[model samples]
Target: MPDELHRIAAIRDPFEQLRQATARITAAQEEVTELARLRRRVIEGLKDQGLSYADIAQQAGLSRGRIHQIRQQGPRPEGAFFGVGSVTIATPLKREAIRARPVVAVEDVAGAQRLGDLARSLRLEPTFETIPVGGQIDLNRPNLVVICGPRISTAVAETLAQDQRFQFERAEDGPWTLVDRESGQVYRSGQDETAPRNWDVAYLGRLPRPDRNGSVVIFTGIHPQGSLGVVQLLCNNLAEVYSATNGEDFSVLVGTEYDPDSQEPLSVEILTPYHLLGDLS
Candidate 1:
């Protein structure tokens, strides 16, 4: 009886082993949660220093919603346990931060005015700048939004010229056509070629900046009306437009149909799904 008891004590119990493993897992999970909290604190610090939420999300490999969630939570209390020990993380001083408000460059006063209204509606507070057609631009700014077609906004034209995914072309007295550079597919506004012009094609894309510090959003069209339509779409259907891009660097073409008499947009339709640019990050 004594020998049997000794053997039972020496044998490993699966249930006991599972209990010990579970305890270790719980400890590891706690540590991970602590680290995540610290990470959110650091993100908030960077945001306070003027880094845009989109830029932070790109750098951290996280979604903008996640970044917003962290910011919305506000600051953590002091003496919070950051790891195994209760360490009160100190907030760092503000660094020299880049301007968070983007610059919205347009070709004409009308386009600039429309863009300004759209920005205000979206709560973007972007600076509006009017540049001459075919003029040279440095594009040194961290963030920019260009409006109008290639004939007017040279920046938008030049950017599209360099991009191999899509091309915008217009012939003498013909409708503007957006060509898929890879697939050779062509898209134009309106169904009938002979029908009175009541629709326009617009291009919207987020591309990597030359400095690689941030991104540039291009909203241009083959015609002036097209540019206005793009802005209207942005202001009216921001969530739907943004959802298509999903906060990534992408290009999309949209067609807007308007009443010829009133010149008011009747409907806006997405011409294509978001086409992602490769590895802009």
Candidate 2:
């Protein structure tokens, strides 16, 4: 901190000094926000371990009142599963049937909006973006969540290809499916059946970003219902899901049995075990 201040002080131009100071403050603001979240989590975690506020305060050199306040404040730590401070949700634009113009699917919009609401509840800012019709997208961004399928987005497909454990592709038999490499089990959406049922399978994972600085959260399925069902799963099992991965880069196939009329998931199940990325063992 002193070194940065000294650097700012050494600046000859006052305007440049002011600009550097401003940039430093902006960077500090993000750090401060993250630190507060960490403080709150630790304070509450101690309480869960049966430590009294006074006990924690004594150990941490803080007052009991401060401990109480910290426990109730700051962003929810579990929200970090989706992102840190802000998350940009990127859905794909599908071409209109007749007009052949790019358009966002209604179900995708609902899923994106619902996820946005979930992000807000976690005290994270949410914004929306759309992958264009040809599937070209820049996957090098911080805190990005993509809700597009591999068939629609080649970029997403390429990202998924980095995972060696499973593959999403169509077999000669017909339907596009998520195939488990080790077990060789094929997971196809029930909607693909001859006697179509009200079920779908979705893929959810935290994939490595192209830049490799961090990762991006991705969820997609054979159909839009798969994505929608996964969103509901997220809304209900966020904490559990976050605990399962701990924000690691991994992938899982989700099976969802939903209502035929409303397309609401009645049951959601994790089909395959989590295939953790960067785990050679």
Candidate 3:
């Protein structure tokens, strides 16, 4: 009986120890969370009043260095773990970072005569010069000028300056067409043709050419709406046009909005450009 009581006591002691440990952990977590919440409320309140980090730190009875460290450090307060500002959870279709990419030039107007032959070979009609002023460029012209690339530069200035008509000041939507290597189709947005593209001459670059991977082209235009849908459509259509074409993955970013207050630039982003690649197969 005494041995049985000892065994029971031993089991009860371990359980009691476990309960104590759990209670301690829970208390510590609760304390840390409460402290973090209080600190955040203080910081937020100060921020709401337009207080600088330095100023808020001064008021918090802590050094600016300490407060700043706390604000920027990892392992945020447990309370904030699920609260707002805890994690920077990104949307699945996040846009690419706004920045510039480099590009190589494919043609100068001197080579414009070769465009029709190239377009015909590609089994596609090329849009020559897009006069940015009134109407679309005449694609049938013998001198069809096309730039392929992905970045910004003096080359863009040259393209727009060649025809004042090509310099678009404002725009809305587009049935804009672009060729895709994966999908050989020239996808067009159903938006109005006059809508401005989200382009920055300083940051424009080139997209690689489909036929000769060795060759590339630069272009000047941005779809006011993101190019993802249109690019995907183009990719799918290309698969139909060319039997040998395999479904390849690619991304296209389009659509931008300028802020009214700060005039800051905002754009829609689609991270998985290749999501629809295998759907056709």
Candidate 4:
């Protein structure tokens, strides 16, 4: 049986093959980690060169909070995965009240409350802004988060309109829809007059600055329930979401089914992978 034994020995072992594959995966992970480190160092160097946070964020296509985090390199605070520096909640106001005291809609207040709580949990400050439809917006914050939909916040709508990755569509006499610009896939909310109430879709993404510096995180939904779901997802599963993005800028489209009476989400689904694209600069 020596010939048989020799033949068996000549064949490759399955365990060895698995071990080699595992080694390759580990090596690749290490390489990614190293590259991240190098990128952080470059950002730090830029900060040292007297560049403002906005300028650094603009150059690196990163959030101001992310740059600040890299610069500090300190222990991470609990629930701070998004690396946000400040949060802004945009609500609708009358055209004549554009420069006057702003009035906030009930739905907008609910959304703002959820996001404000999330910001406080992450030890970040929150700001509430009232903008009239189609009004001017200040988009120069270093790390900013916007909470509004196309119907209320013209700034958010305009930003999404200019972006080729996604579109927020609200046609008369139909349900609100979120369209994927590249794939032409549509996610709709059950808000039509004829349709029974059902699920809603939300758009969440960290996009690059459009006019000025820093990054913008947009939280918008087809309806109030959808906005609530987006906030819930971020608050409850931020770490998981952050891991999915590998700490990179990403956008997500989510579908959430909620209870008709309670207005609570029954289930939530991440409709797409963390999409990597910046706003049109």
Total clashing pairs for each candidate: 0, 0, 37, 0
| Top TM-score prediction, candidate number | 2
Model 4, span 54-153: residue lDDT tens = 8988877889897787756632333334344545666556343566555655555776787778776655567887766565666556556676666765
Candidate 3: which stretches are off by over 4 Å?
1-12, 74-281
Higher-ranked by lDDT: 1 or 4: 4
Which consecutive 10 residues in model 2 have the weakest lDDT in total?
Answer: 272-281
lDDT of 3 by residue, 1-281 (tens): 56634444466578776776676666566566556655654565566688888897777778887776666552222222112221111101112345433222221232232433333332233344422322222222221223322222333334333221122332224333444434443433333334543321211112222322321122233432222222222223332322122213222323334333432234432211321222211
In candidate 1, stretches whose alpha carbon ends up further than 4 angstroms from where it belongs are: 1-111, 170-175, 189-192
> Which stretches in model 2 have alpha-carbon errors above 4 Å?
1-29, 44-54, 279-281
Cα lDDT tens digits for candidate 2, 232-266: 88999887787678778888898888888887778
TM-score (all chains, Cα) for each model: 0.55, 0.86, 0.24, 0.62
> Candidate 2, after superposition: displacement of residue 33 in Å?
2.6
- Candidate with the larger lDDT of 2 and 3: 2
Give the number of colliding residue pairs in candidate 4. 0
Query: Candidate 3: minimum summed lDDT over ten consecutive residues — where?
Result: 85-94
lDDT winner between 1 and 3, please give it.
1
